[model samples]
Target chain A: MSFAQPRYDGTSLALGQQSDEELMLAYAAGDLQAFCQLYEQHKNPLWRFFVRRGMATECAEELVQEVWQRVITSAPGYQPSARFTTWLYQIARNLLADQHRKAHRRFTLVSDESEALESMASQDYPDTITEQGRLALRLKHCLGKLPALQLDVFLLKEEAGLTMEQVATIMGAGLDACKSRWRYAVANLSKCIGMGAPADD
Target chain B: MTEEEKRLSALYQSLDKENSPEHVDARILAMAKQGALVHTVPLDVKQPSRWTAWRWPLSSVVSAALLVGILFFTTSPLLPPEEQAVSASSYDMVPSAPKQARREYQAMPEQKRQLAQSIEREAAAARSKTASVLPAAQISERLAEVDRLVASGELQQAGTLLMSLVEEAPEAKARLSEGQLALLQEALHRRSTNQ
Candidate 1:
């Protein structure tokens, strides 16, 4: 189920008006309003990250709430040495890692079965979707075919817009290794989508 | 650039076409407000200090020390009267009658008092022995062990050991002596520069 639509007056009094780091610092100083703004800005993109990663829609929804809760709990002591999104997805990566470890031991991976189920459940859609939406969906499906590490690198780079160095830091790998993962991810996605890469962009 | 590199670059552009959802701004603000309220409510009830984070463990240790001290003091009378007087008088003077009364009080439960005193004496002896045996040389030796770990390319292990030393050290010098800190700094500098 979708979350209730957040109400916003035109006034922009919430954290949406501020930079992520500014909002985080404000939240640290005991401003709950700042956290709400930060959450509002991140929730959908964060949810989509999990959704495109082929998590079950229900699982993605639950995980999105849990990630926000963690952000709220940690806001008081946050020290932003990097972009707020980088710090956030670092937490998300860790949670996803734990979930993968548990899931690996419990289930065989032929495909992300839960994600396939969610896609099947959403089949009653109009054919008049925007071109961008169609392309994004196609890309998402192709992304699911890559190895887990490559997919993670690709998503962090493309969706989160982290530099390769920052992605390396988050992945706990040397820079070259992260770059290689990204290269592999992109090649695999292009091939799977039958685009074989756009000629000269 | 190679075809692979070109492909990757194009893929990156394709991926960048997506935008963050419109609702994210509102959700983050709401959550921020809730978080601020949670933090403020607790402070209203009790003003927390920077050190309150350490209070649970500190208070736990203090409570344990007080408990042990009480046990030691109460069981002193169960020892031979001479030892009791020596230990008690070393700390404070009480009336001779009160001392005798303490003996009589403990005599009614001699076995329990004897068992407790035996345990207390053993604990006290163990603590004293530990204090006496911990030499500066032993601390230096531990630092040397950390250096060896660092030399072996086990930086993570070395870092963990160094962190524990910093935490447990009585003073800055004691926690990470000048030599050890210098060594650690050198290693970190080397790694960062090399990278």
Candidate 2:
């Protein structure tokens, strides 16, 4: 069960066009290009996954680095029973869980009106870009208030581009439970951003 | 889900596109490179190969030591019976040549007096012992002296000289000329007549 073994000569396929699983296997075998490509594919999503969970940029950066490090460290033992993204997100989720355990809080809320306005006020806002940025900032403030489980599912959905099934698998819950979390997160966030509460099912 | 819900999700997606720091990428890549090298290497192979590497030289040294041991054991019995009978000397792997020489001198006199008396008493014994030992030149000189004594009519001296010559080496008996023998016989007869 190698996460990153010296090199996997399991398949001779071209790395650039390979599947995520194939790239992971190749990277486990010490194929540098495969790792780079996998990194490129997942870096933004992983970073955003942490940031959207209300982690500071510094904290998110450390977590992101840790997730990738775990991937490298565990490469030798990587198995293909589940999807590579499933395994990758599981590591990130576990790290986030650990952070939560240490802090005794899911995340810090945008508690102060002044700080939210201050954070949003410092950055430039011009035209539609400014408007979108403002709304996004406002939504980010509201996201901080969502329940931890819902917020996690929502972030995994949009940030990691995982399917409902994948999110459920990572969260270690039933598919219906994942759906419930996503709906609650969306509704709460929508109301906070001045959209009306979601319609009843 | 409603279009608004979809809009909200899409807007959340666009909310942030943060990237990982450069150091993170560099660190992970470095670790991966190290791991790849480790995968190819066999860690425990060195000690056994080190022992194997010395095998040829070690075997040669062992073989040389065995040969020397066999040679020593085989030649150890060469010590004479008296030396062999001694318990302490039995442990000597190499009986020294100079020790045997010393032992021979202890039994033999420092000078030639005893050797001369022994030869005089038993001419035939000395003859056989010295046959392969003394050089030919010394024997020739002794024969010439005997001839001189016979020429000068010193019959007693000539006869005494003959006895010494034969004692030194009995083979010198054949060195005397017929005239010299006849002169010695005449001298002996004259002595008997005088008596």
Candidate 3:
């Protein structure tokens, strides 16, 4: 999930062009257009962040709704002290943690490597499904197999476009710990997808 | 990140195109619109002008001043029609009396001053015909006793003292401010109702 640069168009060119922090401040000051532009920019990546973390589609939608509702209700107290994405993902991460605490089931890996590969091979790949397509499905299963902390680090770093430091802040871990988790996530995911160890090592 | 990590990131992106459902977007946007409506004041826009900002405080001050003026005027001692002439003259004779009357006399228009002078002459002539009454100081002491009686709930004694003060000194009520007179009357009324 790429955090795309905001695209400006129509009458909202000025507001749409603002940095996320500025847009949030405008939203806090009661600008609906600014909020709408912000929501459009982030809604998908935010939803995908939860979806890729093994949350059910309905649960993901519900979390997305809750996260935005918190953003709206808490807008008045928003300060431009940090990047808006950091604040947004912090909310999402906290909500996900809360959901996990309540369910106690999200941490269980849904498939093993044998099951994933077996399922992948058994499902007749459509003619148009490229070599990369099979691996993408397999990699997703590999993500489920990652330690909860490593997956959280990897997902926040990659999916939310946060820097290692920002990811550390959101995950409440040290920068080096987050980097190690990311590297481990990458190596683990690579092995699951048959890419083996990082060639650079 | 190494080449392998880059490639894996690319693969992940390929599968990451899922969006929140359309219904969710509609519900959230509608909520945002409704929220904006409730928060009518935009902090960044429509700054209040100096006058606009000051209007409420200024109006409050003016209202307070008007309230004080109304209370002062309504509660001031009011002389009956007969005493008005004598009171106007007596205001000059008693230098220790409330300075408010003298200040009012000075502030009065020329026509009102002329009327006060004519009334003063009539009062001076009538002064020779009637007996001199209790001084304002003595009347004030008696009024204070009435207050103490009312405070002690000795309304029966307070009423007798009040009637005697009125009978003995016809000018006593004129000396009592409207607020003091109203309180004395209330105490007397309470005594009669209790019987």
Candidate 4:
């Protein structure tokens, strides 16, 4: 059976809402229930990360499975030096890299013409619209138009709620470089969405 | 600060407000159960033997017999006709000669040499194509340009140049290969290390 089937209940969700590191520690200590909770917490976001990055729905599903497989395989050896989300994102990033490399190698002839970023942009917009939807739509479009690195920095910072420091660590970039990319991403996104430069936080 | 900038920030904050989806919990639990089962079954299968003293040696004998049976089945085709005839005279010896021939084939120098040569040829062809497509001089020049920009403390310009170089080069689209795309990575690495 596909591992994509959901396995938790309302009570489990309530219990599983604990921080990732806590859940992971429990899982490492032989608490299968904790691992289930951790998986429940991350599956959708991880799925969306791949989905929004231009992976086909089937590929995204497979990637989600692979990500969890990695977690399962590595759990006994997992060290909680950072937040569990950080570790999870690190895995997601590696998987994304490998996927991109494989795709590049497979479609070497059509590499330039794939319009991956454009495809990703098209996939990110929601179907339904509300009163406040215009801005969200614009933001999604702007995010799609960003350079891949800048887009990743923006997504990790804003969507994932990672600190610039954590983003720098994840991206293997200097803090200043991360900050600079964030600034550029924000500025470019603003310009694309007909907004000016970002205000100082 | 412009009103537009404030609005954009507010918009971004709004986007970030969407909570993680509800179904993630269920998926996690399923995955955990699957993981537990994968890890638990092998131990369970081995548990009975550990509990019984006689069963352990009996299990070992059975395992060796099974191994020999498998070796005999897989290797019989490799035995010479004379060896096969001699092995056929006795049931136990029938399995042994074929297993020996298979083991010998596996360790044979000629087979290994042929495999190594094929792999080497494939690698050489791959290297040649990769080398031919990538103009080494052009890459070096771009690297030099990035170095010049960084040396002048034009960090933003260096970044832009690096980005442009990566865009222009098919190989550097991925972030992991930033070294091949630009010299900025080294400078950035040095700066971070200094910090």
Candidate 5:
């Protein structure tokens, strides 16, 4: 599922190293190559975010595609007011909320753990196993058990590699509130995975 | 913030690559390329030059001026002041067709009006001169023909004939026999009352 980046060839070479905001500004100014670069950068993280957002049992691919489509449609008016990933994720969140409303589902903070367990259980593991792989599997189980909001905060930060302020902007909350959410999400996830709460104790 | 949090974040990332599906990627990339090609395509709608941008407002102003010029010429004092005043005043009211025709008639020039009246008078005089006093035999024969038409039940035709005889006005009917005159009058009365 990895979308190998389009070769940074010819006209795209100069824009390849530009920051996400710079690339977005260029895309807004009718540079599609810059958009391709941004797309190459974000497509995976965005897809994973959709899959792990606890609604992958639904049309995760379709939702991910829709997120990219929105990115394309909204390119003309895009502003560099915040990080491009923040704006992109914010668009993703809005689409997610739209899907929720369309399904007549309430906005609750509980991940459906059974679906996550069933998906993991279907994958027969190889006899060869690494310690890190085992830990990741255990963490995935804990993620399903995490309350929906904490998992959301944790996943957004991890998936986008976003700063607290950027996460706050995407979540429509103050930075302090975002930090508080992130801290609680981390502590609870650590406890669930039997990782023992951090040195903050 | 914490080593534990970094480890947790790292574990989360390692579970799966889980990139967008191939169909999804292909679909989105195709769209992105299509959009790029669209923008890169040669455009029929050229970028507006400074003058081109102003063309609409300038054309609008020119059109408004031309309309004003036409209005001013039509209402100017070069035409008869009284006629202009009357038209301008009437234009302020919502007039019907009859009123508009009446206004035009009232606004006719005095010379034109006198010529029209003279023509009408001459036409009436010619009509009167054409109506000669008929011999008694001819009058009696015409009355007999009217009687035949009335007998045949062609009341409308009989009425038309009666109207032509009376075209010179009511006194002209005095030439007919009393019975024929009574029959013509009755036919005319029935047609008129029915209408």
Candidate 6:
């Protein structure tokens, strides 16, 4: 990301209250306990992050494995220059971009809003499908309909639980641009999912 | 955040229940364990090989010896000039340093040449300290003459010449090697005994 990265001041958190950066540093210094704890904390969020980006379950699993492998291999070189999540998501983002390039399936913005709505309308729901299942399916469809960049912003914010600044840092976009993309994603998804009309910008 | 945004976030949270499969978890955990084991063992708790155990002390001893050898070869007078040069050249030939260090070490031959030159200059300076008063050959000739004069029974003349030699080159006695001084003393003793 070309955005200005946050700097870590030398001041440390209190003992027994290590931040993600501390855990990473400990892991780098060969503390397996720290790494195990770190893996436990972020595994689900990272998994969901790949999954929500429309990766197949098998593909997402492979990517998850690959990301951890990268983290392990790169541990020796890791600096506490930015938040660990920002760094983690940045790796995930790069891998995702590489996968897209390899597959020649770079996600483009949906050309027609009606096509997304029509796709939603044509889906045949089983009689046994719960309301939650239907909503999740609709949400997945709307997410797919979004521009690749917008979906990235939304997933980073909602799935990774990153702030706008962290998202900007990870995405290499300006903070204002990140916020705008996030708003657009939310508005589009809100309208597509019939969540009581899209909120006014 | 707006009410609509909150609702969307809540909706997503409700549906975001997908966990990574147990097999994937096992695989990732296994990877992390392997990685941590590698990281810890290579640095924090590594078992040293035989070479690794000896590397530091051996390198230290070698470095100290090299430094002492360079100092002695460049400054010591007991070693002949040719031997000093040979020692300097031999030290230069040691291929112990790394590539970058060897690149720096490549300049060492020139430095050793300069050191050899400086040593030669010091030897010349010491020789000139004695030769400034009188030629070494003339001093030897005078000593031989004193011995001949003693044998010829010209004791007064031999004593006078020996005294003149001392007065003319007062510092010569200090500069002369032990063997040369012993020869001078023996001639003086012969002259005294003859007297």
Q: In model 5, what is the error at residue A184, expressed in angstroms? A: 1.8
Query: What TM-score against the true fold does each predicted structure earn?
Result: 0.46, 0.53, 0.55, 0.47, 0.53, 0.56
Q: Which DockQ-derived CAPRI band holds candidate 4?
A: incorrect
Candidate 5 lDDT over residue span A1-201, tens digit each: 122223222354477677787776666566777888888899888887877756663488878877887877776656566666777899888887888889897644434443443344344546588867766776776666565556667878888888777787788888887787788777766655556642121
Residue A64 error, candidate 3, Å: 0.7
In angstroms, the error of model 3 at A118 is 11
* Top TM-score hit: 6
List, residue by residue over B89-144, the lDDT tens digit for candidate 5. Answer: 44543264388766775677978755655665577678777765555566566666
Instruction: List residue ranges in candidate 1 displaced over 4 A.
Output: A1-17, A105-137, A197-201, B1-32, B42-195
**Per-residue lDDT of candidate 1, residues A1-201 (tens digit):** 122223323235555566787777777777666666666576656766787777876677566666777888887667666778878888888888888887773332323433442343244436897755554556666666556777778778766777888788788889999887776565555554444532110
Q: Top DockQ: which candidate number?
A: 3
Candidate 1 RMSD to the correct structure: 35.2
Report the C-alpha lDDT of model 1 over B1-195, residue by residue, as the tens digit. Answer: 467656555555565433333454445456656777776665546667868978899999999999999999987567798677545642342244487856664565757756655665677677665453445776677788887987898876786576555444434344575656876676566657779
Q: Rank the models by lDDT, top first.
A: 3, 6, 2, 5, 1, 4
**Model 3's CAPRI class?**
acceptable
**Interface RMSD per candidate:** 3.9, 1.9, 1.1, 3.7, 2.1, 1.6
Clash counts for all predictions: 22, 15, 0, 8, 1, 0
RMSD of 2: 17.0
Evaluate all candidate structures by whole-model CA lDDT and list the values in order: 0.64, 0.71, 0.77, 0.62, 0.70, 0.76
TM-score of chain A of 3: 0.81
Tens-digit lDDT track of model 6 for A108-191? 654546456546645677879887777777887777667788888988888889999999999998999888888877777877
User: Where does candidate 4 clash, by residue pair?
Assistant: A7-B26, A8-B26, A36-B28, A36-B29, A39-B28, A40-B24, A40-B25, A40-B28
lDDT of 4 by residue, A1-201 (tens): 011223223234444365676666556656777776666566656666666554566687677777787888777666667776777777877887788798783322112323543343344445577635765777765554566667677777665667788888788889999887777666666655555533221
- Candidate 6's TM-score reads 0.56
